[model samples]
Target: MPELIGIARLAAESPSLLGKKRVEYMSLTTRSYLTRCNNPRMPFRWMINPYRGCEFGCKYCYARYTHEFMELRDADAFEKKIFVKSFGPRRFLGELRKLPVGESIAIGTATDPYQPAEALYGVTRAMWEQFARTAGFRIGLVTKSNLVTRDAGVIASASRRHAVTIVVTITTLARDLAGALEPLAPRPELRLRAIRTLARAGIRVSVNLAPVLPLINDSEASLDAVAKAAAEAGAVSLGANVVYLKDCAKSIFFPFLEAQFPALAGRYQERFRNNAFLRGAYPEMIRERVGRIRRKYGLDSSREAAEPELWPRDPQLTLFS
Candidate 1:
């Protein structure tokens, strides 16, 4: 007999009724919550995404390939067919304890935990509730939703046990451009407001200006506006990375470019045709640009390290102690 079930089989068997515009949630069982990241370049050792597939439908999203694992081949499926993981608090907390003490765990690395479906499921909120009782781990949460502000109290409660940093991704300070690129995400202004709120709550917050799409939002003035606003919002730092296009992303992004920016479409095709990442002076140029912006705003270039005093004193707080 064939295997009883797989992700694809389960996805087809049951798709939750909690639907949003052009998107649906499919609940799936998971044996683990924390996924180990072996990529040496990544600062974090483990990551957790409360959901699979993003509703934001960002044209340049690199995570779209994630759907392929479930046999969902359509490029748009990554956004429209979201998979909500079954949360097991006991199993999740057990996994957290298995991790090495002080290792970083980033939430929303693969999908926005605060996506619209979160309003109904509360998976992200539940996860934070668990963190509130734990300690000694470095936790980072990244999102593009203002909804994160709703959890300020939970975040603060968690910080009492663990070091937490909230990273809000703001690709461009321009409303129209952000609307076109990240069509379904919260507005730029709203995200900024969320940043300010989190900062005022005494949570260490940073702004991520990632996948700096060249010829789109890569101008010095654009970067400056974002850095300036981040500084004014009391952000601890600003981080950025030039856009890198993998085959999966190009499938969606290239068509988007043709429709939205016909003039620059050819150039992007040429730049990414041979390689996923741009080489030579381009990356260095952005680093220098970001460095200057960071200096201008008195912002650090890296995530803030947890203060020694913030580490809980209880022997049980540590994973190995």
Candidate 2:
């Protein structure tokens, strides 16, 4: 593992080289990195994860499963111990040149790129520089942190050249609720500020009211408030979706729910029982409510309607195969 001292040196000297070829020694350094993903359900054919293990520590983070794959345990360590991928920029650019051009690229697919660690690592900015140097590709960023504002210049430039959409994921405007659910993420207001900053800079900005916890953040009033906020902030698009708890996320999320909203915990259990995906009328109900709010706010329903599925599945790829 790279030691903290070496990581700092690398970050200071060359922060963008996160791909495999540039990585010589694995270090426990606080460096910036990226990963490539080919999940069919994802809208982009490729993805870049600048860091491993999220500091946001949202109880319902599906990326928690990634920690186990990295041979790490102890959920508490998720926030403190972050792995920075070395030589990320070089690797990313190299791969970018080799791959078919003009494909959509998604950042922050697994872990947020603008998390607090970014203030120090500077990997996300480095990655943006690399993307800016290249052309013929669409770039998308999904983050819950307002820190993205720090790079508004680069984001705005990227928008001018290619398709770049910034999706700010804010589940609820309630600070208390946000704190309880996403213990380490930035407050909703700060994320809203980021939206405003990016929008003012002419960058395409959107709001993703994701993981709308059932009986928690799923209220009609809550969704409307979010839509209103997004529109007022100059977001060109808005979207909402029910929370899906998978793997260890269930373990971490349910307990938090039981403690925070005791009265409605049973309702969630009953609703999600035997259903991996939250189904039935709840999704439609929320979607309809969100649509009505968007129309009322004079926001384009087209962005919401045209939102691409995260991934397009291949029928030929069977589960077993």
The digit string of per-residue lDDT tens for model 2 on 74-189 reads: 55445545666554567667676664445677888878999866877788898777766655556788999999999999877656545688999999999998998898899999
Worst 10 residues of 2 by lDDT: 303-312
Please list the residue runs of candidate 2 whose C-alpha ends up more than 4 Å from where it truly belongs after superposition. 1-38, 301-321
TM-score for each model: 0.94, 0.81
RMSD, every candidate, angstroms: 2.2, 8.8
TM-score of 2: 0.81
| Deviation from native of the Cα of residue 5 in model 2, angstroms | 26
Relative to the true structure, candidate 1 reaches a TM of 0.94
Compared with the true structure, the alpha-carbon lDDT of candidate 2 equals 0.71
Q: What is the Å distance of residue 258 in model 2 from its true position? A: 2.0
